[model samples]
Target: MNISIVLILLLAGAAFTFFAGNKFASKIALLVSVASFVFTLYALNLYLNGADLSCKSIWIQNPKIYFSLAVDGLSLAMLLLTTGLLPLIILSGWVTKFENEKAIYSLVLFMAFAMAGTFLAADGLLYYVFWELALIPIYFIALLWGNGSLEERKNAILKFFIYTFGGSLFMLVAFVYLYQKAGSLEIESLYALALTETEKTWLFLAFFLAYAIKIPLIPFHTWQANTYSKAPAIGTMLLSGIMLKMGLYSVLRWQLPITDTAAKEFMPYILGVSIAGVIYGAVLTLRQKNLKKLLAYSSLSHVGLIAAGLYSLTIEGFQGAVLQMLSHGLVIVGLFFVSEIIFNRWNTYTISEMGGIRSQATKFASFFMILVLASVAMPTTFNFVGEFTILYSLYNVNIGFAIVAGTTIILGAFYMLRMYQQTMLGETNTKVFADVTIVEGLVLLVIVVLVFFFGLYPKPIIELITPSLQNILNQIN
Candidate 1:
């Protein structure tokens, strides 16, 4: 079967899960997601064994649009990340009760469909459609199923919606402009356009606005912490684990190639902002008392470094960015799941309210400690591999930039360790903190194992993504 089958299965699963009703909705959703993941693996095998996975068809003759989908090493890696995490995301919420549980599960699958589409679509307009489609499910997921006071949730969700939606309009405008000038909206056509520096600069900034807000870089990131805090664990997982990657992916896939000259011209400034965000996010995390918000801010810091690597416009930079995206996605989900487990036990997210769980629940604490170390980029974890590569790329650009960005490791370790101490260490809590349940243990184990496994032997992933990154670098150069 073609790669499109992955999308078809997920969209179909969403519909079936919605109709399956609440009693079996989660199970159905999990099954469908797993099926899609398996299909994606089959697709990857086909791709690896020298098969062409791209498909294209006419949609709008006048605008010259096509229902196009393409797969290469880069897109395949993202597809794997998306499909791989979906089953875990589903399982993370398995026991949590929600209003209209079937609907929640349905939305999750639908979001997956959109995300997979976003990764696969090769036509510019088609990509835009999938990009915006992803926002709808998450909006509802956060709005309806999120926690916090009604007004707080409403305000946070609205801000996130407005920021992302507004930013995307600029990207849409860029796509329209590209279509007008190039007479086609396919990615290759946009890349081929011989635009003037002035035109390329405008187009680059427009696309950057969309991606930055989605990546939520710096000033654009105001919506993130509150939204992460307000949303339920599952919603937060989908957002942090998969959604933000769309923006970073787009940077490599769409932005830099289409605006290569402009990207080169603006590299220094953009790198400055990204490195600044790294420090900014890490510092902010140091002050957070709320567990979710702290993790949220930490994500901001990590992604900033990833964005910097992409902007560095080197092969190592691209590889590091992709690797970190996967590493961060898995580790963040595990951390959020841990936070959810704590919330389930204590019914609170306040850091000061937790302590000494290590004494009672060694398994839970061990899992958490591993995830924490991964977050801090411990030597043998995937995070270290990704972060070291990224820092090395930055050092190639400017030693000062590398030096500044390196602070993330130290600052990350400090705040992350401090947060771990307050939340998982200290005297034993009076409340009984049970060890991880079987399902929870399985989830954490998978994440931790993958983290270390990739860290130690990154050859396969490096080899998988190298050619795709080299192609993008060629386009940029």
Candidate 2:
């Protein structure tokens, strides 16, 4: 195992700041997060060069517990998203005024460590550990920093925790069952163990339950809107941008191959659920008054489309799902961050409370409009590339499903344009609305460039993930 040591360095930096004073603490956290971001890039470079970074250490030998860390093309892509987004999240947190800056900064860094671990861990138990570890920091972040009724925020966090954790228990059972069969906790070992049809069926359901709740396919998604609305913007960014991808990634790493038969057998039903979610979420977005809730539903709708693509059970669908995952992550992070800007200046998130920012700040309105367009899958945006691929892939499966999925384009435009118009156009509500700050403009500009860059030329990412995607697709019976 050739260790990258980036994780080690990040954890070390976090540990060092345990006793640091308030003034320098945020600075320390910021520097460490930025460093981790650089190291993440380095890790990606290593992966691109075909260097393998797999390491394992025995943690609980009697129970066969082991700490395993590794990265592949898929995992590397997620790791890059996780690390790249952290610096921005950290910066966003910094721009906000917090009462306990030290604790807030420390908690954010800790959250970063947990997220990084989630992407890097290879052992089932280790992955679960990192998976649960992520919830703790975020729970606190929401409870302490969220702008909402205290009890309501607490309840939302508690509900979010309970729902996800409850699903994970079944996942734990599935892993234990696999351990009994494979005699090891390593993912690769478990992946190789042949299971009877019945066993695969039950294990797949267990895995599906966990991931479904997380990606939050309909009926299981009650916690998403409330949580996203109550939590701080950065918290919403983390949950939507990268954490939700945990489920999609698991579909590749665990579900497709291990439960190939079950997946194939139930493909239509899964696709149906996804389509329902897409429409349900979009229609609900049309009725939302809060900007955060609107974005939450929009994300739900987008994830549904990705899930539908994954269930298409073809190479095109699989690759499109992967691309969509990356595209969505980047787009949501930018959108939520921009929301933070709007909320900061206007001191409100309700669309009804905002009007006529277009004349006041053309630059701000323009950038927000770009993000809006990206969210709506406009041509020359990353979302367009992802959605096109998914639609094409769906066409291969069933033209009907593809046709249904295509409505998202129209639905998305309706809601996004409506959102922009309500918030940025019409009579000026206040005489004091200011343009985006320098830091804010830079952040928006960087995201906009990335949105168009990936949209115009996605071949590089598609090419990078091709080999691994084929490997996963081949495992599908």
Residue pairs clashing in model 2 are: none
Model 2 spans with C-alpha error above 4 angstroms: 1-4
User: Ten consecutive residues with minimal summed lDDT in candidate 2?
Assistant: 1-10
Model 2, range 1-477, lDDT digits (tens) per residue?
Answer: 244476776677666655686677777877888888787777778778877787778988778888888877777778777777777777776668877777777777777777778777888898899888889988988999997999999899999999999999999999898988988878778778888889988988999999999999998999999999999997898899988998888888877788888889889999999989999999999999999999999999999999998989888888889889999998999989978988988788999999899989999999999999999899999988889989999999899999999999999999999999999999987657789887787777878898999999998888877888888888886
Residue 55 in model 2: shift from native, Å? Answer: 1.3
* lDDT, candidate 1, 350-440, per-residue tens: 9999999999999999999999999999999999999999999999999999999999999999999999999889999999988988889
How well does model 2 score by local distance difference test? Answer: 0.86
On TM-score, the candidate that comes out on top is 1
Candidate 2, residue 220: how far the Cα is off, in Å = 0.4
